[model samples]
Target: MPGPDDVSIRNLTQSPVPYKVLAFYKFADLDDCETLRPELAQFCCGRKIRGTFILAPEGINGTVAGTPDAIDALLDYLYGGAFGTRLAGAEAKVSWSETMPFLRMKVRIKPEIVTLRAPEANPARQVGTYVEPEDWNALIGAGDVTLIDTRNDYEAAIGTFEGAIDPQTKNFTEFKDYVATHLDPAKQKKVAMFCTGGIRCEKASSYLLAQGFEEVFHLKGGILKYLEVTPEAESRFNGECFVFDERVAVTHGLAQGEARLCRACRNPMPSTRACGAIG
Candidate 1:
């Protein structure tokens, strides 16, 4: 079986695909976001790469799309010369698209890489334990553990781990209130959290810890990593995983699922024909 890196490389070289989307995030103290923005913009523009990259003191988070060679070169520079040291074990979720998804390349500095708007929820200081994808099934399946899906309502509606609590939160900021009322940390001893790419849950788990939750755990790389490794037959996840890109959703093995985003509501629809502008 091909590993995640193998799959990413295969997607890039398999065909004459026009664009490949790379989504990734890293949590580390970065103080030179202002200086880094212009350098990144120049490199990407010179290579004809188009996408948005957000830099912050916390770290970097963004999605970029470009030709196979350009993408590889960009990643090389990011992991090597740009950061001064390697990103260690950073991995990106790679997907293919026929047309360019972004109009232009931009690098902007932000306060937080993934905004939760909770000052107390600091992943830099302390966060939940990292649960590997292989061990995720057993951990969440345990009877005593409380599984919480940290994604937005629409993202959870498409798919999530079986029996996981859907907070039905409209946005990440609402998660603080949802946990305050819906969950009791005293009763829920072991809380397992997960999001699309693990970024949201990083802060969510931290919030839970601040709220006095003793045993807070989060998926190491989120649902994307789980689907990439777990076989369809043995998968614990149900339905398609919603993504923030043109492909919309993906199933087990990272294959594009049968779902499209409604232009009006931005909700996942079974087909374009079903998108009737329903909010």
Candidate 2:
């Protein structure tokens, strides 16, 4: 969970957890992505913030972890217009961790922040309606809705919403192919999609809308937001949500799950057994 909104109470020394990890993304035009890249890297480096950032012409997407004070400074630097243009409407899913999730920091500019490799999937132009976490169940429960998990196959293997369709694609680029071959807008008119942190779903929803889907809805802030707000008793998530970091996965309430990545195969397993043993 995020630190107190009041900056004065955000002192790192007083917090129970020393590190605050933030998964954030925003879709906006960034004409100066290249120039802002090195500058952003330097700022994060100076603040000791460590995470991978994808800066692109479309927008910014990344996860960073640091002390509360440092994180506050980083957010202030980002939204405070130090980069001339504010990352307007950029919000993050925050959670406390005792350890840093990444080994080092990186800021690289790419063609698209969350690439579906389809120009039509531009969130800057349009995207599906945002469904709040609390209202997600009702939306998906509707008989006319088709919920698709837009995360990669590996991610879906560990956990996903019950009854949601898994496209089983190895990578994001394959999503376009899956849609073209397996899905039809005229048949599944009302579709909903979700991803780890809402970025992929945003792009996917945009693509679906462009493909003539009658209605598209995406989980606002994605699974992380849903887990944060939904209690375990009411949760539709069956297993741990796989994350792209040392944490591997997180459960309801965003707590670190018991599952760990196997040392050999790097697959998530509930036990500490070797890959073969688990397999």
Candidate 3:
């Protein structure tokens, strides 16, 4: 992480496009983003636009949406420096929508972007083995592996692998706590976990391995990447996929279209919307 004294405008100001921005970067100098947050708030507040950013020693992850012109200007300012350079390959998925996407812009400092309870798990560490959709299908069909849903209870309620075991976490950070206590004694069984993007599995899988589970695996690029590459109809993934964008939940079996996001959490609600028999 960058030293607190090193914070400056030249590092944390990189921006790429307008309307909305989504990015995830590995460990970086924290002072850079902290220094920029207030400046960003002021820059965005005056324009009546909101941008949300979360920064930490482990890196920064966030999405900010606003007017086209304002967004472009912000990106220009951000990308112009070294601190923001880490966002170079950051994923910025887009969609067409008419709703007011965000309520306001917020920038805060945290310990991690996708929180995992184990502070010892470093973002700089190498990741767990990733399984492409094709390989994933073959493995699941083999019937010797266990599929774990790394997302919260609600996300799994919407959709998941045919027989995936939901960790039922309130958030990703709680996942480590769940695994430490509940893993079955049959440790030889192959284990798999997945999330919207591949990042969460990176942390969760490693933490599971640390707990002595062997043959750990996770869906490479998570379900989002799977949808982009594999045909949804041919794949085992069922129901709607929750997205970070305004389109909300997308049907995995179909090409990209408007998502059916939950009004309460912005995650995609399943076609049945039958979470724990909420009815």
Q: After superposition, how far is residue 59 of candidate 2 from its true place, in Å?
A: 0.4
Q: Model 2 over residues 182-230: C-alpha lDDT tens digits?
A: 8898799789998898999889989998999869999998899899889
In model 1, which regions exceed 4 Å deviation? 1-18, 272-279
Model 3 has an lDDT value of 0.63
TM-score of each: 0.89, 0.91, 0.72
Q: Which residue pairs show backbone clashes in model 2?
A: none
Q: Best to worst by TM-score, what's the order?
A: 2, 1, 3
For TM-score, the strongest prediction is: 2
> Higher lDDT: candidate 1 or 3?
1
Off by over 4 Å in 3: 1-31, 39-51, 66-85, 88-92, 95-100, 133-135, 184-189, 244-246, 253-279
Write one digit per residue (lDDT tens) for candidate 1, span 1-279: 222354445454454567777786777778988888899899999999998989988888888999888887877767766676535445467767777878888899999988888888888798999999999989988999989999998888778899999998888889988987888867888999999888888888888999999899999878988998888888889988998767788888777788888778979876535656764
Candidate 2 has a TM-score of: 0.91
Q: Residue 108 CA error for candidate 2 (Å)?
A: 0.9
Model 2, residue 263: displacement in angstroms? 2.7
- Give the clashing residue pairs of candidate 1, or none: none
Worst 10 residues of 1 by lDDT: 1-10
